[model samples]
Target chain A: MATLDIKVLGPGCRNCVTLDKATRAAVAELGLDASIEKVEDYAQIASYNIMSTPGLVIDGTVVSSGRVPSPSEIKDLLLAAQA
Target chain B: MSLVDTLPSSKGKLALVGAGALALWGLAYWVNEWLWDWVMYGVLKLDSANRVVETVHFFVYDFLKIMLLLAGIIFVITFLRSYMSVERTRALLGGKRSGVGNVLAAGLGVITPFCSCSAVPAFIGFVAAGVPVGVTMSFLIASPLVNEIAIGLLLTLFGWQITLLYVVSGLAIAIVAGWVIGKFKPERWVEKFVFETKLHGEAIDPSRGLTIKQRVGIASGEVSTIIRKTWPYLVVGIGLGAIIHGWVPESFFTSVAGKDNLFAVPLVVLLGVPLYSNAAGILPLVESLYGAGLPIGTLLAFMMSVVALSLPELILLKRVLKPQLLGIFVGVTATGIILVGYLFNAIIP
Candidate 1:
């Protein structure tokens, strides 16, 4: 299995932290080989063209911006990407 | 590195922080009163008859006082903001019924500390977390209108009585307006993308397990950012207020918008809808109007409309909401504000 690349983008606000946790849980539950990186710089976050924070990026594609998805929902997203 | 490594170990350093805050408070008071007196009356030698001079004095004094207040309030609130994250709020409101959710969301809105412009992210987060749209609306409406910064400024300028009344009524409006919207079942009005977008990643709560040093650093950054963004509006609002204070005849406003005028409440609300201003930017104008003998009801209505029914916020909401839902949102909020205005006027006057 190929390792997955995941990025959580925000200024370290509470919602962003929740997104980070949920993502970690989803990855672990699926036993996926993935590396999670957090990007907090405003310029870097803006480069993604996301006006809202707590954004998520997987495999170079923007999947979500401005909301925290639950672990189960995140699991479906990871499975789809794996396929 | 361990978090404890960053902790301040010296008692002297802690005492220095306390002393610094006291010094700043004294300086702020001096700037608010003595500086205005020295510059406007002692140096300028301008009498009340000189409308231009008086207006200039009003502008300078209010500008300084409000800026000082903004810095202090924003710093403290931003520090508190680090404690209350959007995800935390989502967890609180998620999976609740509309009635309970609306109340809880509105209450949380007062403490969460996001401005109207930044509310979208939280709104989206709430929606994705399965929070009802109506509950989310309550949070959005209450966040901007009932924030502590605005309330602190209001208390400084208008006294605690008026401030408390504003807070109670504002929250009531947010709660009722949101509850009514929830009943409308406007879920279809949300953009398809809001529901469809899925994020995949390891979510870490950035505010979790932070040291005091880190929290303070974050708060100071917030103070600078908020002040930079809001200063221009504050200047413009105070400038307009000075003009009104110095030039406009008391009789003029009283005749038009006084308590006797039944149409004043709705009329002011209509006038306020098109203008975009935050509470800090608008309260100075409200003070000048009150000074000019504008009825309390009309002034309150105008302030609410300016903060709560701002056109810029409406345009921002348009991104996520269809026109129909947006229309309902505006209609319901405006009506609630107008009623509050009338009710206050009847009771007080």
Candidate 2:
């Protein structure tokens, strides 16, 4: 099993918070043992080279940025990574 | 006075006025073009043969075109001011029963002439004036969904079929989605701080007598007010779009939003947040995305997301909606956009 590392990179805005919650929900629904991290530091968020914040980084790859993904969508991403 | 009384006297006056204004507008346009030329070719010296500079020039030209459009829009809106006030809209929308009310509200929302980004004041005023949130939502969703400008550009760039699909589907999404949002009754989520400007100007009935000159003057005012407020956002949105146009690897979009990708529509919707644009600014890239074998649904989803879910608008709306409401708005809108994308894909050959 690949250990999937997921980071929700954003400042503590409401959208950021919403993305974080939905991402966690998505991970839990999939029953994946993936680790979820929130990267709130501006310097850390900037490291992703993403212009828009509130991004979702899966396994060091930016899967989505600038918007929140639904839980089911994230579940699919996690499942794809496992495959 | 009636037209019969004023026709002879007003003809020369109106003609003179029209000529003067057009000349003034032409001069302003020329100066603007010259400034842009200098900035691009001379000051920046970016008009070189380099492809990069060519793309940069494309951005500059596109920016100026949008500015000119906005200027023209401003001039027109200055004339429309007396016609499109918040109070007038509410009375027209008041006493809304469901079926036609929703459709009428949605239709009015489109022709009511607001760019979604710049419609904030009217939005607040609508909410404050006791207009149904559903009605306001209909306007909010529809106003930016389709417009004459977007339609004209799409028709010229894409085709009549695409344009027709865009208009029909855009209206459908605004109506259905707005009705759905209304069912949820989101008023509770609005922040306490949102001011509902109590005045809500008295509604004007078109049946009421007004001279053509008065009507023209009002329309002009409406055009100017809306254009002035919205011009900067349009430029910035188009500027970013041009940059996206100039760069953004084609494979990136094709891979992510390819026709066979089931996740394309939803993924594109999720991607639309944080980016802001109008339909006109995005149709060019959308055309290219289609050429890349990406699904129509995916591109449509992306267009909806970018225009409707931009982060800057959210930041601005956060000044009104609470965290939960904003999230719901984003979530619901994304769902609507994705659904519309699939609908188009399935229904359109």
Candidate 3:
């Protein structure tokens, strides 16, 4: 089983909520053993160099930002990452 | 007497209102110039730089002129409301299907200067009007980048090179960025409201002729509405422009933004995203950046961001789009802006 560390980063805004929901759904569908983390600290978020929030991080890499990824696209990437 | 009430008919009142507003503005300009000059030397410790100051001074003063021009434009739009129908839009931009032709149509998008952020209303209207996704995207991107005021100012200050670079890339980004948005037609990410406009009115029917009286009546109403809509924006916008014009220093801008700093270009793009500004307001800043030593790519990136990602326009767009699509637009625009900034410097002189 592949394990993934996913992060939904924002200031607890509405977009962050959507991204968190989307991330959970992606994680469950892919059947990957992943723990999702939400980073809301402004300083920490700024350190990531993302001016806008609701960014997605997979395995410490910011994969998608400024928008949430579609479930299918996320699942596909998860499948590939496991393989 | 109250300004609106004093005028006889609403339309006649508007003309009188226009005259009153201009009179107020002329007085304000004189006071502003005198106070600003004093502050420049006394508090700010800045003085006329061997006459470079005058040109630089024009940078800010010009925004005031633009505000006045906008007022005139509003008065015209008041009358134009009757004549400037979507049917007219179809007449002008319709019938041409060529890529180059489509681009030219898209270029005209900048002339409209609509809000840059994702809005349900414009997105709805464009889609409902059956404008292609790419074409709509081009207009969306370019609408904020180049406008008459911005272009005229660029031409006056920077000469042909800066102006040409601005126009070509502004059009190119509109086309390419639009195509990219089209490619990732993640329909699901678009909020429910955004799709509503697309649900109906997919085609434009033939235009009907208007009677002379109907035309005149509509024109008068349009002038009032458009003027009212555009005036608040102009006053607040020029107020900010005057500040940017007077305050931001050349040495500081050049030191940070200059050509040697490779990262400066993307830095500008990043900086521009949050601010609520238009091409007319931002052009002066961009010109100063170049004067200060900013790389062309960086300046262009900043310009696109200022035009495309301003907060007020973004708020307007959010009414139509879900937060996800909004984020995508901002993200995509940032990336596209940076890419084009580099492209322009490479292709042009």
Question: Per-candidate RMSD vs. true structure?
Answer: 8.5, 20.3, 17.3
lDDT of 2: 0.64
User: Could you give candidate 1's per-residue lDDT for residues B1-349 as a string of tens digits?
Assistant: 1222344646677447747976987688686787777877788776756777778878988888878888787777777777766556777886898999999999988887464544555556567668999999998888877868778887888789788888899999999999999999979998876665453333334445654655665566566656776788888778877888878888888787788899889989999989877776777778777877877777888888988888877876787789999999999999989998998888775
TM-score of each: 0.77, 0.56, 0.53
lDDT of 1 by residue, A1-83 (tens): 88899999876766688779889988998999999999875445545545457778888776765545545557877888888
Could you say which candidate leads in lDDT?
1
Using DockQ as the measure, the top candidate is: 1
How do the residues B1-349 of candidate 3 rate in per-residue lDDT, one tens digit apiece? 0122233455565557657866886777566666656666667777676345654465456555555544444444433443333324434554444355347556656554232322333455454445554455566666666555566666766788878877777777676666666566645555554344322222221123444333334334334434444455555544544454556676676677565567876877878878656565555556544655556677777777877777877775565456766776677777878888877666655
TM-score of chain A for each candidate? 0.95, 0.91, 0.86
Candidate 1: where is the Cα deviation over 4 Å?
Answer: A1-83, B1-15, B39-51, B199-203
Identify the CAPRI category of the predicted complex in candidate 3: incorrect
Window of ten residues with lowest summed lDDT in model 3 chain B: B198-207
In CAPRI terms, model 1 is classed as incorrect
**DockQ by candidate, in order:** 0.07, 0.01, 0.01
Which ranking of candidates, highest DockQ first? 1, 3, 2
What does the lDDT read for residue B198 in candidate 1?
51
* Tens digits of lDDT, candidate 2, B1-349: 1222333237578767767877887777677666766887799777466767766676666666555655565455434433553335556777775456668777876666443433444455556656666667677777677665566656655689877887887787777776776777778877543443333223323323555565554345444544555566656655556666667766876676566678877877877776666665565567555655567766777887887778887775675567877777676767778888988777765
